[model samples]
Target: MSGAAAAAPVRRLAVIGCGLMGGSFARALRARGLLQQAVGVARSAEARARAVALGVVDEATDDPAAAARGADVVLLAVPVAATEATLRALAPALADDALLMDVGSTKADVVAAARAALDAARLARFVPAHPIAGKEKAGVEHACAELYRGAQVIVTPLPETAADAQRRAQALWEAVGARVRTMTPQAHDAALAAVSHLPHLLAFAAVHALAQQPDGARFLELAGPGFRDFTRIAASDPDVWRDILHANAAEVRAQAAAFRAALDAFEAALAEPARLRLLIDEASRVRRAWAPAGAPPSP
Candidate 1:
């Protein structure tokens, strides 16, 4: 892992997707004076218009291929399922020396997609990345320049990834006020499955289970802060999360099973007061100890 200081500005950045992650990236770089111009691509003309109006990019287009042409850097922030298709479309338009990266939640699938979509020459310039930051809120409307500040951005480069490509990806994220770390795609997928994917599944399940009851609306009316905070991620865009979860299904299932086993143990402990107390004490201690003095818990 390495930290990046501000460096020379990128001549042009083509941001595909132009939604939360992509919009934030462009805005952050612009704020830091590290970007000269940015072209944004979105599925809808309305979204493209909004991105430009919000200053997320200097220009906006519905055609990703046209946007990618002559770009110094190409960022694919589209849904995980659409990554391969996006890469394929951008291949012909890609500058010979363009740096390619992504903000997809799952790394393995994105890496695989890039490998399948690009020729060896283009693959060498591509570096897979995931910025571990987001809000429950969705869309380009919520994007802000400070979103990546103090955030952790994981760069998972393949064995064949060029050394210069890896360095450029790291430096770009760092210039936008992020801490960069490197990991293998497989390791990145497994870790994210446990910490991110499984928790989202749990949140969605909690909300869905409640909504299926006869008194669902009544329960929701009586819900408090704990319920709200715990299930906030359930409000995330279903379409986006569906693509991510399915792309990394195997690891997600394994992590979900592990989580279920822990829940079962906790339920069984409820029958024994002493055992339940011990479980509570252990969880409390661990959670409390996770934070250093005068610091808040990590996201």
Candidate 2:
């Protein structure tokens, strides 16, 4: 989207932690003929084998550094908690001119980690990106080349980030059919915390609360489409969510507190029939109007 000329297709793409996000990225890039070779890294041998078998990568390994050795682009797709350690491991093996980016949910902590782990020269090539796309599913087995198509990808570049690196990152996402947007890391984190993280936390809490009731199993048997839709995210990988929630704790907490206040207001309105109806109507109205213009629900 920038006026700059397009860079050459990536010769070797190294993906660290090749799960749903990373595997989907490799699949998408390959589908567009933008990637020549893909190397995937995962902590588990079974995962590595699965990635290779699924054609997500040409080769797989447990060492991030090894996978990154000759890469033209390195995509960090590990959990938020594992990002720093992975970056530190790859730092010494990274090529001087290789582009670096990530798909982490939170950006501030990742930017901080890059600052601490990478030298100034290498840091310049690192761009922080978060793709606003995924399913409740996890694992490379569930990856799809079209996952990022028509999705929004947010690139949060630091003040010191190199212009070329930022441009390349945006271009790559665009080539993969993602709409790119740029913002500061702080703003990105705050916005995601409110829209993404808080809703996930609420879903997890709701499911947990329901499971604790004496008639929990019976209640679950009677759950309808509304319950299934609302709690869909509660089934997301807990380890991944744990890292994201912890990394963005402050903003998540603030959003959670705000949500609690709203819930309390609803509870207080229970004694007033008219007020309760008004509250429900207000919430329904807001939700109905919140969908992006021209965006349709996924089939």
Q: Please, what is the whole-model Cα lDDT of each candidate in the order they appear?
A: 0.88, 0.90
Residue 274 Cα positional deviation in candidate 2, in Å, after optimal superposition: 1.2
lDDT at residue 166 of model 1 (Cα atoms): 88
Per-residue lDDT of candidate 2, residues 1-299 (tens digit): 22113645789999998999999999988887788999999889999999999999999999999999999899999998888889999999999989999999999999999998999889999999999999899999998887887778999987778998888888888777778889999999999999999999999999999999999999999999999999999999998999999999999999999999999999999999999999999999999888752223656
Cα RMSD for predicted model 1: 2.3
Q: Estimate each model's TM-score.
A: 0.95, 0.96
lDDT of 1 by residue, 1-299 (tens): 13334466889999999999999999888887789999999989899899999889999998889999999999999989998999999899998789999999998889989989999989999999998888888889999887887778889988889999988888888887778889988899999898889999999999999999999999899999889889989999887899989988999999999988988989999999999999899999997776432222454
Overall local distance difference test of candidate 2: 0.90
Q: Of the candidates shown, which would achieve the greatest lDDT relative to the real structure?
A: 2
